[model samples]
Target chain A: MYSKEHKDYLKKIKLHNLLVKISQIFILVFFLVIWQFLASTERINTFIFSSPFKVFETIISLYQNDDLIHHIWVTVYETLVGFGLGCLIGITIASILWANKFLFKVFDPYLTILNSLPKVALGPIIIIWGGANATSIIIMALLISVIITIISVHQGFTNTDENKIRLMKSLGANKWQIFSKLVFPSNIGTIMSAVKVNISMSLIGVIMGEFLTSKAGIGHLIMYGSQVFNLNLIITGVFILCIVASIMYYGVVLLEKKINSKWD
Target chain B: MSVLKIKDLRKTYHTKKDEILAVDNFSFELNEGEFVAIVGPSGCGKSTILQMICGLDKKSSGEIEVPLNIKIGFMPQGDSLFEWRNVLKNCLLGLELTNNVTKENKEYVLNLLKTYGLKDFIHAHPNNLSGGMRQRVSLIRTLATKPDILLLDEPFSALDYQSRLAVSDDVYKIIKKEKKSAIMVTHDISEAISMANKVIVLSNRPCTIKNIYNIELENKSTPINNRKDKKFAYYYDLIWKDIDYHV
Candidate 1:
């Protein structure tokens, strides 16, 4: 009797999961059909908002033209460099602040002000200061990503188990040992979550930088396409950007899973 | 020579609002290879005494003298095992951190793991293990450091009754085999009676030792086996009475 009930329970769970998956697929199809019908009917001007088919055609053409790879490489390089720089700087600052409570208190007001301001608004100044090169884009991306890393890492350091810290100290573990073994390992989950958030922010910073001032990159392609009223190019660029960001987010998620599995 | 000597130890927490004395003029001595258990009420600052001995917390005023060359191992109330490291890695963590994981030390730790019935689960994560297994792992982690003195702060309090008994027995055997002196803190009178050679009973807040009982039994036995000894009930009653006076 128990076995039958357990089997029925499992069957119900499977059926419910299947229903959710089907509904998700149905929603996606519904949106796509509506979009296709509206574009074909000219309800929205094709020049202003290209059909998915036209965008796909543009993507193929760009790929075939060989310029797409160069643009993609440039964007990828900027995002990676900016992300690395942001993580390094943010983690360093957080460590220093964690070690020195007085320093954290001193810098608290400045961090608040910096985080509150919209970093995109500084695009013109950043370009002027960094000569509209990769430096400007990197600076923008760093601005977008660094605050998150600092806050998350600082919180991770602060939230380390007090008893564990005490235990380490009692076992003759020095300050550095405690930080490396206890503080850092315990905060891996928080740091990974912060990295996931930073991926999209990094992309946004790069695009914003390019949109304001760049001769190349997907951001430049979108800007140029918009100026020329080539909505297909713009849509294609947007789609590629989304895909890249998703891949980066999922890559970090995979890494987090791999690291967590060892312990969990 | 006494392995550890505490003289007129006093600890006070000075906050903005007030100064609160936690441990007041407490003193004790433990000879080499002695297993001491400190039992007290919840807020009696027994932990403060252990913290001072381990040098985790500074005593406001007191003197703690231990042999200069002797090392100390501390097992806190919580498991304190790194959740990211498997049992083997966690066991070797101290030696790894200290850059002292020599081949011989690794062998010693591995042997302990195997002998303690953790051989099959060496690669298991702390979260995946049972509470008793995790506590055993924590003990092994501390023992792996090869300290001369072990300070256990309610190490078995987190375990269920059955697991606690089994773990207490396991820990007792390991400590005896290792021949290491240990000081444990607990609120359980029966536990103190069953496992300790000497039990230190403490008073309420601003805690001080109320009484010290030297446990005498007919034969050597594990903690569980000792619990069945005829004198076990008498010792339990006596210690319970001492604790009750303070509470």
Candidate 2:
């Protein structure tokens, strides 16, 4: 039996929150519908702009044709392979950089330059070196993700509690034990955050690589769509890409929550 | 031989602007099983002395001599417990980090936690615990490593007044029962007088030991009870005067 005042306050807060969420969704839908209407009325050229219904129809037809699933599998395989390779190389290089202060100092400037350079520019070079195949796409993805991971993991290692390290040393713990227990656990959050950020970048790198060279994958599908002015096909490809990226991002978030829940 | 000995210890920070001295010409020694409290003004570098003793910071000049194979446990002013770790995991962190989580060590640690009334909250995360409970967990974590000497840098200063008193009594009973030597840094004169067998007062910045007060009070009294002792006010007045003079 809650008091009327208390119940009213709760009701008001819930209503306000619901209204805010509804307004956001409404605004997004309104813009999409306006775009769809404009494109369907021929106010915008169908070559450059497709109605939302046409995009949905194309996705349905693509699924029915059965080629979409194979392309999706190809892209997914390339992304997963690239992500694994990127994480391994990044973690190894980060550990090495953390172990050697002199190495970090020597390479710091060069790393900044490399990180600043647009990774897409290297698409041609990566293709030239690794061939115009999945290898090139994976290599391109690694180039985009590795630097970020290395920086995050290295910072995590360097920023571990000095007092904790000293305490471990006093307990007869060697350098390796300290690193394994203290430094590694402390950096889990940072590493997870880096992973989430890199998932999107890895996908982008793979797609760009495929766009430039691959005969298979969603990137090639989108390229074919653009060549024939099939805006619906392009939109369908873009929608699928967004879904994949969201799933990957949310996957990392879920993992981070699971790991962090224990500590929290 | 003393369990710990420091001679002419100095620590200075070299910066682009000017040379800053953190701990200058500080020296002291601690006997085994002794509880020593160091009291100083906020900026008097008391923490720097503890940091140097714990080997967290390098000494600019001096000799710190100890037994060849001695273990040191340090509790910093900050909680320093990983927010991600549960109370039990955090308490076991020192042992885990040292790879010394033997069954005996774990039993000893758990027994201490039980005795300290934290058994029920073992699985709870650090954030879920109260500030006082978190501090207790941190203290247990340090003690679980089975250090020869424990360094506490204002361990209870972060707690509320009531919790501070309760935790201080629990901690005092613990250190005594464990038969461990400890050096605690505190700005609270009453806390230092109540918890310590010997209170070392330090002068202003680039600190040096000014006076050492050996407290003789009713044994086994909590810090709050100790405050009511006749000698408590006297010692407090003396420390307050000394600190005021330096300021």
Candidate 3:
């Protein structure tokens, strides 16, 4: 028997959810309208600020010229390759650290230092080591993402409940069994969190790498646009980067939701 | 025939601050299918005894004799159900760990879940289940290994009063119906007296067996029946007094 209050409560929840969705879209559009208005009114110099219309037209031109897809693809490919490798290497290293407490202890301080150190500062060194190519860009992204992934994922593996591990051990489960069965499954949320941060870190590294050397990609477009004072192209590049980042972040969110629904 | 035997078992923790002895010169025998409840004060190292029996903890000095190396299943406090695993998968954990997750074993576990009133919740995750149901799943996971003995550590403490009584009955019935020997460590005296065929009372820190009571009540089928058997209160009081709650 669903009472009136119960029915009302469920309806209220549905309404609240709808309201949240509408408000989120409203905020984005509101910001865009304000920006366009400011540029049109000349309150902000359209020459430098670049009106939304100019940005849109710039995007259309880039699309028509076929450079837009190429640039986006380049950045996306580099980021994806770097992100995948970084996560794989990072998780593998984290597993090694988790398996050997002594090694972890030896590397703990170094890991901490690496995690805190500004990775972009090593750009020149990386360029020297890997050469001024996609190699350096991918390495830069890996450096930015991998150390943080190691630290975060290792923390997750190590922070797995001691009680659960004991329970597994008491069952005569071996070290690998404990890792596969208990530690990894229990830390899915933590690992997903690391992945989210790792994505952003990798993006930052990719953009930074492109800023220094890349002849293609959204980052290069932004840099080149600024050199020639084509503010429209710069703003358009910024918009594209924002859209790409949002898609990737939302993709991770979708993955998290799928995993949680299936497993959690 | 006894499935487990422990004599002169001792465990001491040597730390920087001091040497702390947990279980001290403990000895016990668990015959096949004999339900033993180890009741003691909180922090009396009752769980330590179970851990030592399970070989998860090292003993300083002891003699442990198990004929043919009997399998032992340990269910720790807090359901400890993997939140990520659904009820059926959680139940299958032990079998999966032991590499015994065959078709027959899967069916057997699924049947066990069905018989234990978890038929409807097979696909539900641990978080979706009530405390009692999760505890039941934990117990089922332990039992799936087909161990000669079960070691449970205050599994029902997480449930409310009503659910605790109901689940204790359910667990007791399953244990008896399956002819399983169980050594459950709990601070609840009445729980020990009601569910156990024999109760071992342990003393405070540097814990050792203070007294052992062979519970006898005619027609005592389940823990719920044990409560109605008139002698429940007497055993509860006796063991309550035996536990040394002192510094």
True-contact fraction per candidate equals 0.81, 0.35, 0.65
User: Order of candidates by lDDT, top first?
Assistant: 3, 1, 2
> Per-prediction TM-score, chain A only?
0.93, 0.91, 0.94
Give the lowest summed-lDDT range of ten residues in model 3 chain A: A163-172
Residue pairs in clash, model 3: none
lDDT of 3 by residue, B25-137 (tens): 89999999999999888988898888888888888999888887688888887888888888999888877887889999999999989988899999998889887788888
Off by over 4 Å in 1: A1-19, A61-66, A228-230, A261-264, B216-220, B228-247
* DockQ leaderboard ranking: 3, 1, 2
Q: Residue A136 of candidate 2: its Cα lDDT?
A: 89
Top of the candidates by DockQ: 3
Chain B vs. true chain B: TM-score for each candidate? 0.95, 0.93, 0.95
**Which regions of candidate 2 fall more than 4 Å away from where they truly are?**
A1-32, A39-41, A64-66, A262-264, B11-25, B57-72, B97-99, B216-220, B244-247
Candidate 3 local distance difference test against the native: 0.89
Top candidate by TM-score: 3
DockQ, computed on Cα atoms, for candidate 2:
0.40
What is the iRMSD in Å for candidate 2?
3.2
